[model samples]
Target: MTDEGELIAGRYRLLSRIGRGGMGVVWHARDERLDREVAVKELLLDTGDSAQAAEQAMRRATREGRVAARLRHPHAIMVHDVVEHAGKPCLIMEFLPSKSLATVLAERGPLPAGEVARIGEQVASALAAAHAEGIVHRDVKPGNVLLADDGTAKIADFGISRAVGEATVTGAGLIAGTPAYLSPEVAAGGEASPASDVFSLGATLYAAVEGAPPFGDDENPIALLRRVASGELVAPRRAGPLTDVLLRLLAGEAGERPTMVRAREALTAVSEGRPVELPPPRRPTLLSPAPRVRRRTVVVGIGTAALLIAGVLIGVLISSPGEPSAEGDQPPVIGSTSERPDSGCVARYAVTNSWPGGYQGEVIVRNDGEERLTGWVVRWKLPAGHTVDEVWNGSLSRAGSTVTVRSADWNSVVRVGDSVSFGFLGAVEAGEGAVPELVCLPD
Candidate 1:
C-alpha cells in the first residue's frame, strides 16, 4: 500500500487512505478531470499460486462497480468510473466527509432514539429502492452506512452485492457478510434475498440501540453462523418498538421474516412515536384467563318490559288526526347547511403542496391506525370553481387532473396520533367547493 499524496492511474492524486478491508484499500483522491475529491478503492493483485484468485477478485471488483453504477438513489453513493492501476482494479466513488455508524457508536455509546430512527429510515428506504431494482445488498453492517455531513445516510460498499438471479460469487462456500449481521439463510449457504437485507438491517439497528451486535462475542465466522442459523440470540430490551422489529427480522426461517417494506413501516412507526404491537407471548395452558358467562335471561326480561311500557304510554298520549303536535315531543330533523372552507391543505416536511396561489384547503391527518407514518405523499384536486394559487411548507408539482405535494424530507416521518397543519391559497370562484384528499404513506 502507498502513503497519502501518491498518484494512481496517472490522474487521481491520492490524498490519504480512508479505509482498509480484507480485499483492498479505500483512498481519498482528487479527480483532476472533474476537479473534485472522490473515493478510490484499489484491490491488491495476488501472485504465485494465487494468480487465479487475483483474476477472480478483479472480475468481482469490475462487476460490483458496474452494478453500483447503475443504482441511482438519493441515499446511495454514486460510482463514477472503474479502471486498472498497477495490474489491480480500482473504482471511483462519490467522496463523502462522514463517519461510519461503527465510529459513532464507539465514540458516543448509543444514539438518541430520534436520531437512530432517522438513520434507520433512510437506510431502509435506500434498501427498498435497491431491492425493487433487483439488487440485494448482501452486506448491510453499520460500517457500510455513511453519515454524511448534511445528515443524509449514504449506503456504500457494494463490493459483495449481487443482483437477483446472478450467479453466486463466493465459490468457496464461505459466508459473505460480516458474521454479526449475517441473515440465517445466508449463514446456512442459501441465496440472499431482499429479506436478507432486512435481517442485516435489524442486526445493525440492534447494535445501534444496544451498543453491541445481538450475537455477542463469538467472533469466529463459523460459530457466529451457527448461532444465527439456530436463531438463539436474545433481543435488546428497553429498545422500544425496535426490539420487536429486530426480532421479526432475525427470525430463523426466511419465510417467517417480514419484508423490507414492512420492516421499514414498523421502524417508521417507532420513530413517529406510534405504538407497534408485538405478537402476544405464548403462556402456559394452565394460566390462561377464563371466559365469562353470558347473562341472557336478565337482558331479555329488561327488553320485554321496556317495550310493553312504551306501548301503553303511546296509546294514552296519541293525538287525534289533524291535531297540532307538541313541539317538545316532535322536533324537525334539519341538516346543517353551513359550508365551512377547509384550511388544512398545507404540506409538512417530505411532502410538496402544489395548490394554486390563493387556494386554501384543510388537511386532517391522523395516526388513525396503530402503525406510525415515517413519511407521506398527498395529492388532491382543487375544489370546483376554485384554483390553487399558492402553497407553503412543501414543494409542489402539478399535472392535469391532479396537483401533488410531497412532504419535506425532514418532516416525512410523522408519529402516531400526531397531526400536522398545512395550508395553500387559491382563487375562489362563486359556488365552487374546494376539498382536498390526503393519502398518507407509512415509512
Candidate 2:
C-alpha cells in the first residue's frame, strides 16, 4: 500500500513504483538527504511462516544486503543500504533509467546473435564479479537485466531474492526464479550455486536469441517446473556461433557447467567471433556421473503432470544409453568415441570439447577380463603435428607421435565390469584427425 510521496525512514521519499518482481516491489525514489535518485526494493516475506522464522529471515536478509553493498562492478546495480521500514527489509540501490531486457525482447522479438552475445558478456562479467565475492544471484533472467539509456546492461536484485527466499513460500513452493530460466538442479529443489546462475544466464541468452525459452514457456507454473525439472531443452536454431557456449552453460550437472569466470571468457570470445580456449581442468575425475535424473516416483508424488511443470528447465543432454532425458526426448551423447583392442584390455577415446588449435579428450580403459587388473596403459598415435600438452588421472609419456598414458597409483586397479578414465588437453594441426584410435594394455 505504499504510494508516491510516502517517506520511508524519514530520509528517502518514494516517487513512483518502477518495477515489481517475484520477491518485491521496486520504487523510483529520491534520497532527501543525498539529493539524488535511488531505487528502493521492498521485499515481501511469507506471512505463513512462524514469527521466529520470519525474524530469522529478516536478519539473514539484512546481512546479505550488507554483503551485496560491498560488491562494486560496472554491470551490476550497486546496493546503497539495507534499512528496516514498516517491518520489511528495503534495499536502496542505484537507479538507472532503462527498460528491462524482458520488455525489450517482448517488443523486439529475438535479437541478433552478436547483440545478444555482447549483452551476455556484460551480464556474465557482472555475475562473475558477484560470484568471486561468494554471492549467488539466485534469480537471473531477462527481467532482472536492465538495458540502460546509455546502452550498458546491468543486473539488478542480487541479494534481495535470496533474502526473500528465506521466508517466501509461493503456491508452487519456495523456488527463487522464473520457471523458464531456472537451472535443472534448482528446479529439482536443490540449493542455488554459482553454477545455477550460469545456467540461468544461459537460459536468458537463449530466450534473447531464440525468441523463446529452451523449454517452452507453459502458462501453468507446475507444467513449466516439470519441464525444467526434466531438463529437456529444445535445440537452438538461431544461436549461430553462440551454440557451443550456450550448450556449455546449460550443462545439466552443475559441476559440468563452467565457472562464471570461464562463462564470461566464452561469451567474450563469441562476441568477438573467436574460438574459446579453456584452461585444463583443475581436477578432472571420472567424467562426472551423467546429469541427475529425478526419479519417476519423485516426479509423480510431487504433483500431477500439470503441477510439476512449474519447475525449472535445463539440459545439454549428457545421457548414457537407454536413459531418456527430460521431456522424454532422447538426445545423443556429446562426442563420438573410437575403440581399439590390445592385449586383454580395451580403450575408447572421445574428443569432448575442441577449439581451433586445441581440443580436450578422454580415454576410458576397461579390463574386459575375468580377473581384476592391477594396472593399465593406454597408447595412441597423434596425427603428425598434433601433441598432448597435459594429462590428468594418469601418467603420460610420449615418443615421437606415440602417446602412452599409464594409470595413477590411486586408480590403477580396475575391478571386473569396472573402467578407469584419463583425460588430456592436446594441440592439433589444422585438418588432422580429431579422434584417434586408442590401444590399451594390462600393466
Candidate 3:
C-alpha cells in the first residue's frame, strides 16, 4: 500500500494524507510534471468484497473524475485527471484550502441564517449542474461539503454517484448515503434521483442552521434512518427568516421538495436579505414518483408540523413574560425606515440569527440624500427587558432598550445610493416586541 511520501504514476508525488472516507483516501500531493499542487484520491477496495463488488468500486472511483471533469462551475470541485497506481485507480482533483461543513459546525455551533443561506445557494447551484447532466449524487452530507477559505461552498464525493437509468452499484435492496441526510424514499430502497439529491441538500443546510439534523442526531444509524423515513422533524426555533424555506425543503415527499434550481434561487434571495420565497416543485419526477401516503389526523410533514409546534416550542424556549409576538411563532419582519433629516440615510433591519428570547439583527444604512457624508449614525428602541449583547461593524452605546450605533472607521464614508450594514446580538423576554424603526442620523 502507498503510504505518506510516495510517488503515484511517477508523475504525482504524495506529500501527506489529508482525508479518508469509506471508499478512498485523499492525499495532499504535488503534480511534479506540472509544478503545482493537487489532491489525489486512492481508491480503497475491500478484500472481502466479491470480485464484482471490487471491480465496481474501482469503476466508481474513475467515474467520479469523469463526472466531475464535465462540470465547470465556480462552486464545483474540479477533476484534473484519473490515473493508475499500484494496479489501482487514483483520481486527481483540485486542492482546495478549505474545511468541510461538518468541521465548521463542530468548531462553531449552528451558523447564522444569512451565512447558511449563502452556503445553501452555492451547493444547490452545483447540484443543479450535476442533475442537468443526469447525474445523481447519492451522498449529500455536511462532511462532503467543502467550505473554501475564499467564501465558496462546493459539493464533494461522487464515489456513490450514478447516472439516471443506471443500475444500482450497491445492489438491490441496499441503501447508500448517510442515514441522517437520506430522503424518505431512499431510506425505503428507492432509487436515487434529482429529488432525492435535493432532499439530501436540504437536510445538510438544515443541520447548518439548526445545529442538528431535523430528526435529531441519533447515535444509532438504524434509529436515524427510521426517523428520516417517518418524517419526525423537530421544529426549528432559531431559523428566523429561513424557517419557511427550510421547512419546504425538509418536506418528506421528494416531489414536494423544491428543485435544486428553485432552491438555489430562494437561497440567493435569503442571502441577499431580500423577500425569500420558495417556488413550488417544477415538475413531478417521472422516473421515481413520491412515495404515496394515506392521510392521517395529524400531518406527517414539516409544513403542517411547523405551524402546530411553533407556539409550544416558543413558549418552552422564551419563558420570561413579555408582550406576545404578532404571529404564533416569530414571523419574518423585513422593513426599512424612512430617511433621516440630518444625513438623509435610511437603515433596513433584518434578523439573521435567532434563539429563544434573542436574535442577531443587521441594519443596512443607505445614503439616499443629496451630499456624501463622511460618517453616519442610527438609533432604535427595543422592548423594556431587551438588551444588546454584542455589536459588529459598528460601535454600540445604549441606555436600556434605546440603542444608538455609530459608523465604524472602515465604513465611515457613504456616497449616494451606497449602503453599509452592521449587526448586533440581542435578547428580549418571551412575547416581547423587539421591532425597531431604525432611523439614520449624522455621525
lDDT of 1 by residue, 1-443 (tens): 48788777778999999887644689999998779999998854443356665566566667767877888888878888778776678888899999998878778987766677778888888888888878788778888889977788877865344321122212332212345676654543334578778878878887788776666545343344446544556546546656666677666555566777777777788789888654422320111222222111111122122111100111111111233434222222211110111221222221111112222233323343465566555666645665555443345777765776665554555575555433343455554443344333433
What count of clashes does model 2 give? 14
Deviating ranges (above 4 Å) for candidate 2: 48-53, 166-177, 278-443
* Candidate 2 displacement at residue 143 in angstroms: 1.1
What local distance difference test score does each model get? 0.58, 0.71, 0.67
Q: Against the hidden reference, what TM-scores do the models get? A: 0.57, 0.62, 0.59
Off by over 4 Å in 3: 49-53, 159-177, 279-443
Residue 281 Cα positional deviation in candidate 1, in Å, after optimal superposition: 10
Error of 3 at 169 (Å): 13
On TM-score, the stronger of 2 and 3 is 2
User: For residues 174-257, could you state the per-residue lDDT of candidate 3 as single tens digits?
Assistant: 222345676765553334678878888878888888787766665444445445655667777678878778777877666578
Which lDDT value does model 3 have at 46?
42
The collision pairs in model 3 are: 323-431
Model 1 has how many clashing residue pairs?
34
By lDDT, the candidates rank as 2, 3, 1
Instruction: Please count the clashing residue pairs in each candidate, in the order shown.
Output: 34, 14, 1
lDDT of 3: 0.67
